[model samples]
Target: MVHYLYLHGFASSPQSAKAQDLGDRFSRLNLSLNIPDLNQGDFSHLTLTRQIQQVSTLFPPGEAVRLIGSSFGGLTSAWLGEKYPQVERLVLLAPAFGFLEHWLPQIGEVQLRQWQQENYQAVYHYGEKRSLPLHYGFISDVRQYCELQLTRPVPTLILHGIEDRVIPIQASRDYQRDRPWVQLVELDSDHSLGNVLPEIGLAIQSFFSLK
Candidate 1:
């Protein structure tokens, strides 16, 4: 059986709206979807490296795995797909490629400096009322995996929103350039893509034709 792993974005959890919706939809088709909490209960030390390690341990080294990632998770998928030949295919939703470069400016140099000095940064989570602590280590750690590569052409599909301010659609467009293996679908939505999830689900079904 092909394992379908769903990786959520930063500050998001396994119970994220997309993950839960997809889990139900996939289940109806008799597919098993694995949604792991990337933060592992300690958001302070979370990093791309640790996320990859967690996925590595969950999945056997040489087994076929299908990936569906969003935003930061999309970035994680890029690294995973490159390193692990077992990733048979991928579906990225508004992947956060080039995030580090854009992030510093969004936060401002002063804020970034403060975060680095304090070792933690507070950001409001989607479902939580209060802001959460995301350590500076998370930002520093992703720099290593910022560069994305696909070692071999695995069947890949990317869904990005044109109006996405968080991670610009142009990032996906630029990333897809010269990469014949990737097929990017531009949707009329925002960064979350929550409004058009049904359409996204249909696209996923058509892309993989999961049997």
Candidate 2:
């Protein structure tokens, strides 16, 4: 039995619409899907290392898992696929490669300096509709994992939107450029990919060889 896991994006949760959609799709096929809360109750101490550790604890000692992740979670999935051969297959949605490079500039130097000084920055939590304090360690921790180049051929697939302004579609293009094994599916949608869930589901079904 394959252990299917869905890792949500930044500031998102297990209750995300995409997660639910996948959960429902898998459920109809009698497959169990796990969507772990990456935040782990402490948004202030959030880091990629911490999220990876949490995910690591989910599976048994020698078991493999099938991963589907979006944006920040996709970045995490890429790291996992590189480090752990146990990740038998991977699917990334609008992966945030070079995220730090894009993110820091958006926040600007002054804001970054202030965040470093204060140790935390207030960011909007979409689900809760309130600003939460995310620690600078979150940004600092990504530096260690950012340079990861995924060369492993773990049956990978990437679904990116053409009009995605959030992470930029070029990021996916650049990521898939040299890796011929990685299938890049471009959809006429936005960053959320909300309009193409059915297409996304079909792609996943085909990748997993599901009926």
| Top lDDT hit | 2
- Clashes (candidate 2): 0
Candidate 2 lDDT by residue in tens digits, 1-211: 6788899998888888889999999999888889999988887788999888888788666787889999999988888888887899999998888889767888999999999999989988765668999999999899887444678877789999999988999998888888877899999999899999999999999998888
Cα RMSD to native, each candidate? Answer: 1.4, 1.1
**Model 1 C-alpha lDDT per residue in residues 71-152, reported as the tens digit of each score:** 9999888888888888989999999889887667889999999999999898877645568888898888877664644446
- Candidate 2's displacement at residue 122, Å, is 0.1
Q: Which ten residues in a row have the lowest lDDT in candidate 2?
A: 145-154
Ten consecutive residues with minimal summed lDDT in candidate 1? 143-152
